[model samples]
Target: MSEQATTTPTDDEQRGASTLELFFDLVFVFTITQFTHAFGHEPTWKSAGTIALLFAVIWWMYSGYVWLTNEVAPSTPARRTVLVVGMFGFFTLALAVPDAVHGHGVVFGWAFLGVTLVHAVLFRVSGGDDASAAILRILPTNLAAAICMVIGGYAHGSATYLWWVGALLVIGVSPLLSTARGFVLRTKHFCERHALVLIIAIGESIIGVGTGLAEETMNLQFFVQVLLGLTVIYVMWWSFFGNDNEHGEAALDDLPMTDRTRTALIAYGYCFVPMLLGIVFAAAGLGMAIGQGERQASWAAATALSGGVALYLAGQALFRAALGLPRPWMRLLAAILAVLTTALGVYVAEWVQLAAIAVVVYGAIIVDDVIGLRAGERSSYLAG
Candidate 1:
């Protein structure tokens, strides 16, 4: 527990993000904001799908960097310098995200490639059998993504989009196929960081919901609606950060190197599906608050809230499944809650009623903490 004893992360310690690493999240915030703007400009199902896919593709790149940094952070001074430069690459890529879909999109493509080059170079310089081995696992995938982005820049239209999307599917998956066993430090750090970053993202949704409600005219009516928004935020808070999350993180932290990496790769790494779902939920709630609630809102808004709740539950289910526990009631309840609220939001009259429906769904999410969260809390899982 002493400071000296904590000098270097061991094979067991969970390595969440450092403060500096957290600052890196600012880039992704821009990425998410860019997607939101793009969606607003052309709010079609296709646009939504495209935006989600693109956001996901960029997120994967960030994930790879985090995974590697968690394991080993450029141990020597020279390598560390390259990493600092890579940070700039991340910022450049983020700045270009808004234009990544078109127009001189090569800025994004080049920025993304530059970041990958940093990782590839890091692998070469780590000078250890283990430190650099996992790099190869991701090399092909990263290269594929890099190539697709760069090529798509010139190709334009559906051909370009399809090319990038295909590349993302392949790139997103290749690292999991990595049978490399030497990435203990990298995997452990990545898993722990995921727990925290996941929280950060969830936190952003809470902020979005609050700010959304706050932007509405504050009167007795708005007061009640704000309370309703806060309540939903509370529900989301409990579902993601309560005992279930703690237990799941503990389970992952204790996993063997390969399992730990796998848990992070496909299962844990995949938790962002819910995180984005949650954000969209908040955005829908925000939209409803800002008087975009004509037609009593729509199926989409309702689905956003409900789907978010479901994704939160599904994340827990996947986490437990990875940790060897298989209870699925939370996920089931989450899906049910989502369906209920979505239906109610679409059918209800008045903003107050929508708020009321959200409350009911959120209340269910809170109750799950008491009932369904027990199995996870009592489980023998805890990442090292």
Candidate 2:
């Protein structure tokens, strides 16, 4: 294949996220929606596990595209065409997610393979020398994982799960199998791309609230419940957007190229799994709980709502720590308390449980802000 010398952003000319990248992320919105709706329909532990597994596979590839775009901007006609083809693969994957665990595993596997192949080809053709060399190192594992998914698709019963698990394991340790030293890190575009995805994921919670409200009467009680749910979503937005991105970008920028790649992989690639999963679960829970606020929440609904918040807070803490930022004691404490609120839903009204969980998270943000102020820093919850 002829190599296309794509324009790469330099330190002096850092670029923000592009319109094409944002367009690509729209497919991801559908991905999240499908998962949220699936779990909302069957808010059981088994379903949650299936969603988590599929999400890990989908997210790994999705984030790979983010890394790909960070290096080789889809600035050329050929690169743009390849990216759109990848988007179609993602859309197909999302469509299969609703039935991935039940019956459509083969379809899911094929779609994933298409997406993976597109990633490898695009990197090789447009990524220039350094990125092309770096992609070659990780390409085997990427292809291996996709093959595992294809095998898992044809698998039966427990064997199916086993094959998918193998795929996850292969992709999970990819960084260890290959060195990250050959890739370039454009901190600005890298941070912006991730931030946009995170924001879009968070938007799923709002969609959840709307879906939950669809069948209910818009009474004063429903309005209050909506407000409380939105509050939780708002806090989720604030937690990351309120300076975490800046801190994360700055932290990565300070590191050497190789260390920066590793840290970005851990901080953005791995840490974001929990955060995104948390959003998925929380959206599922909130969608289930909204209209039925007066009644006691089902075990699945209660756990999904509160546990989702806990997962997000814990993930945020890990992200901060990976960036060598000060430990978020307040967020950690909130994670514990968020988990404890699961009992509230089981015992009390679901709205009451949601309110309590919201308090826990909002309180953490407030405490962190106070601490930041006291330390003479800006009012950033993650500021040391």
Candidate 1, lDDT over the whole model: 0.61
User: What is residue 6's positional error in candidate 2, in angstroms?
Assistant: 6.4
lDDT of 1 by residue, 90-201 (tens): 7777677656776756887787788888877766455345556657656777888898888887787888788778778887667656574655544445655665666666
TM-score for each prediction?
Answer: 0.82, 0.96
Q: How many pairs of residues collide in each model?
A: 12, 0
Best by TM-score: 2
The lDDT values for all models are 0.61, 0.86
Model 2 pairs whose backbones collide: none
Q: Against the true structure, whose lDDT is highest?
A: 2
TM-score of 2: 0.96
Tens-place lDDT digits, model 2, residues 1-384 = 365655553542387888999988988878988988999888888888888999988999999999898888877788899999999999999999998867899999999999999999999888878788888888889999999999998888889999999999999987766778667888888888889889988986797669667779888888888888889888888877786777788889898776888899999999999999999989888888887848999899999999888888888989998898765666788889889999888898999988998898888887786776687655355545
Q: What TM-score number comes out for model 1?
A: 0.82
Q: What is the lDDT of residue 274 in candidate 2?
A: 90
